[model samples]
Target: MTRIFNFSPGPAALPEPVLKQAQQELLNFRGLGVSVMEISHRGKEFMDVAEQAEADFRDLLQLPDNYHVFFMQGGASLQFSMVPLNLLGEKSTADYLNTGNWSTAAIKEARRLCDVNVVASSEDTNFDRIPALDTWKLSKDAAYLHITGNETIGGVEFHEYPDLGTTPLVSDMSSTLLSRPLDVEKFGVIYAGAQKNLGPAGMTIVVVRDDLVGLARANTPRLLDYQVYADSGSMANTPPTFAWYLCGLVFKWIKSLGGLTAMAEINSRKAKKLYAAIDESNYFTCPVAEADRSWMNIPFTLADAGRDGEFLELAKARGLLNLKGHRSVGGMRASIYNAVPEAAVDALIEFLREFEKREA
Candidate 1:
């Protein structure tokens, strides 16, 4: 059996051990005599998986008792709207930081529901760096201060979170969740699409402070209400049973690797190696600033844009697949998510050198 190094941003690579375990139990699912995909979400088999997933997740994040973890279906995009729908309370505006594509999208969705205050932005620089927190002009009575923990398309991340005295802080952590240790108490709410560092695309993980619940607007859909999901234990509907189960396995896999602290060290080392290769080479350039570069996604461009297609083709043939950057930005992007191994990064670096030599 052969598996190539996969670098696609979403639906990214998963821990190999977890994949192997799933393959071994795909049909039987630990003596249940049925695939997890075919079982009832309310049954003991799947319920146990759901409960364990929440517990392991809570352990990994050290979540406070005031926070409630909801395993919902809509991806992070849905939370963009739900954040305003549920948390807006009586405020007419929300503060948002426009960093890159994802942040911009979040802001766009939010604008539809309430008056949006773009507190600060790095769009002027094409999102090569995160805007300084001190420069943010937060509204006096805003609903919440929103930020994207990491921008996947632009390869920029915020290493330090901002402190919003009395206001609640909300973040879209889709691409960077679980990549490092986060202060669960710092943000009032945190949401992530499971595709990046978790299990798959169908699941969305939301950690909302208990106080933030029970405030949805009257017109909010029942499924979009945070309180409903929280009260129902994230089982308001059938839920994504198979995706939830897989995510539980991933949480266990992460625990086995010594939790986020260990994962953070590995991710930092991997990003350093890849960034070093880009910085030391004259043939490639990373647009994002050094301080703001993302540990998971590193987007770089060849000195000659004409060679982008050629580089991608050769890299794929050599077993490095899905290295293409997002269409909005034309270049090469290597998304080294939590499951991507260091050896794969080394292989990519080796290919970079070979390609540079051949093309130069």
Candidate 2:
């Protein structure tokens, strides 16, 4: 069977090694004669898997003991509400930075729960760049400052984080989480959906500071409360056992590759290579500001937009799939997540040159 390169924005590509290992053990995991998906999440074997995944995650990030990691079921979209619900403790306003679609969606959700103070936004430029950090007008009495580390659709990323001092900082890092090393101590909370860099789509990883655990509003549902998951090892109810197991394998895979530092170097090179091809070619154009361009997702357009369909059809014929951009924003987007190989980027670059040469 032939496998094509996949560049989906979500439910993206995964490591072939991880897939093979899972396949070998799919039906009789640890000789239990049952698929890992059929096993009890609370059983001893699955518990061990859960523990080791968290440990490996902490090790890769060098997380401080003060933070608690929870492998919850809802994706980052749910966190848009959960963040304000749990963190808004007596305060009426929460500061937010609107970088792109995700951050804008977060702000829209937050306004429903409380007063949302938009500290700054780059919407004026159609999210081509992040607003300058010095221009942010932080609120003194804000509950927490929320940011999206990367925008999957618009292809903008925050290369540097803000220091909020006493105010809590929350981030939705669905596309950026495992791509590189992070300064965990600077934020009060970090959450990401597993689809991009971690594993599959069923699970969401949430890391919260100890102090922020019990701050959910009184009316918050147990399922929506961070404290509930923290209290029960993220097993307050049945968890996503199979997704958790796969993510654990991904964590091990990352560790084997020298952790986040190695991933960062490789990711940087991959992004830069593609960007250079785009920059040098008069046939292609990437609207994102150079400084804020995402290392994981690169969006670009042809000089003649009419040929987009031809480009996608040709790329598909070449076994380079999912090069289509998000619907809200039109163009081609190549999401080079952690599991995507460097060769795939090289292949894409080669195709770019070939297509441009033939069609330009």
Best by lDDT: 2
Clashes by residue pair, model 2? none
**Cα lDDT for residue 342, model 1?**
94
Give one digit per residue, the lDDT tens place, for model 1 in 108-185: 999999999999999899999998878999899998999999999999998989878879999999999999999988
Clashing pairs in 1: none
lDDT of candidates 1 onward, in order: 0.93, 0.94
Q: After superposition, how far is residue 221 of candidate 1 from its true place, in Å?
A: 1.3
lDDT of 2 at 11: 96
lDDT of 2: 0.94
Model 2 has a clash total of 0
Q: Write the per-residue lDDT of candidate 2 for residues 82-177, one digit (tens) a residue.
A: 999999988899999999999999999999999999999999999999999899999989999999999999999989897878999899999999
